[model samples]
Target: MCSGPEADFARSCVSSITSSGQRATLLTADGVRIEAARTPRTPPPAGPAGAPADDLVIVLAHGFTGALERPALRRAAAAFAQRAAVITFSFRGHGCSGGRSTVGDREVEDLAAAVRWARSLGHRRVATVGFSMGGSVVLRHAALYGQGEREGRTGAHADIVVSISAPARWYYRGTASMRRLHWVVTRPTGRLVSRLGLRTRIHDRDWDPVPLSPTDAVPLIAPTPLLVVHGDRDPYFPLDHPRMLMAAADPATTELWIEPGFGHAENAAGPELLGRIGEWVAARG
Candidate 1:
């Protein structure tokens, strides 16, 4: 956790720079236009003894029913921006982005675009922090793109990966929250409610070939540092979810933090925890 003064400085810096984020309209491989905002790293405090400027950039991926301007997302971005530049974007169908959500399938492309944008902005070191549904997308995207760098294929790759409150497998309905989420994705009436209440449009079809699960993607994230954070008290997924992800990840390069009393996603994340996450990413760099 950060001290009172550091926390206040972080909030103040973010408040002043949040509105000045460089707005970007990124087009995914499948032609979806994703609404993204990149808040450049806050300038170091004045004076020779001030903190050094950071070169790494952190890309934040929000969960279902979340947008770039969502309060939780903004708070997380601010915390990260205290240590590095931050990019927050809306997945298709969530905010002002075009196209419907295919849940986690096509969302991988959305993350890819954001990562590319980060690299284009002159930051060679990039890290991704995702929550809930966004968490799963990070895993899959890393597996698909990160591996390409080692295999001589071309694509955007993240230097580090952090997944919070993510599920290891798909089609899980073990919890009431997940059950409700399934209803929202599978039923027309529930979809209507999601559209009207959440402004999220669900794709009417199922995954064609069934995209790889988070567990399947975990093994492929080796060589790139991975962090798995989950809450014991989360209503959406049980302990088994994070456990499965950790088990599949390369133990030598992976870090696992099972918070005792945390809940789910960005909503449950506090400024202190977000500050800690920024520190962890900086340490890796």
Candidate 2:
């Protein structure tokens, strides 16, 4: 079922909760040291060679201030590792990764680095699966690199995206609770956190807010297929957020699936949901 026999199929998917494992090592790219845990995978056995591996090239990005070893990212990584190659990494400044996390701008670069790492290992297809702020990075990466032609499927770019409970607009979709959280993040409290040296773990330093939010980025991913899945009950990003994504995406390709009662990233995605995701990936393959 996996790329290899037993658990060896996946060397290290960022999914496991055992954060202390060797797979949690950091790799440097473009002067930035980013933490990445590798997960091995292979295609379904019934399929031909070069099929998407059981170890999907899944790059997991942590939510805001979340680290490479965040419990949620780990669990989600593990869940996806059941079918694909998984790579979970800490965004610059979050967790053990280096550099200051600049909202979603610099983080997009980090995501690119992660994807490059996965591609180097012979992965046939790659995807960015993120949560919350992590989801924003996934969208940005797809819009940026998803362009160009496929030399057959071998040279095609990895544009598959999955955002769990993410808001299209951090500025407008900000909820009462989330808005309050951002207020603290953009104010003296954030500065205090940075002064106390917690800056490396979160958005401790305030930066100029950008109008280039998800709504702006969504249009760029026209040709690439997008899968915008969210929890209808998500308190942070309402159903309207995914609706906006569907409205913006190339209706001929992009698809949106809204779960009935899922919460945020930490919640479990059982067979039903994972099955849906797996089916989508297979169809794309």
Task: Please give the CA lDDT of all the candidate structures.
Answer: 0.86, 0.65
**TM-score of the candidate numbered 2?**
0.77
**Mind giving the per-residue lDDT tens digits that candidate 1 earns over 105-205?**
99999999999988887888889999999999999999999877776535488899999999999999998899999999999999999987887878989
User: Which is the leading candidate under lDDT?
Assistant: 1
Q: Where does candidate 2 stray beyond 4 Å?
A: 1-30, 42-56, 148-157, 191-211, 267-272
Stretches of candidate 1 exceeding 4 Å from the true structure:
1-19, 43-53, 150-155
Model 2, range 1-285, lDDT digits (tens) per residue?
A: 112322232233243335432354344435666767785543355755555444346677777767665666666666666567688777876665656667676687688777777777677577777777777878876776665334222232456777666678766535775776565466776645742544343445544656357867778876766788888777777778888878877887777888887877644455567656755665565
Best by TM-score: 1
Error of 2 at 134 (Å): 1.3
Q: Superposing every Cα of model 1 onto the true structure, what RMSD results?
A: 7.9
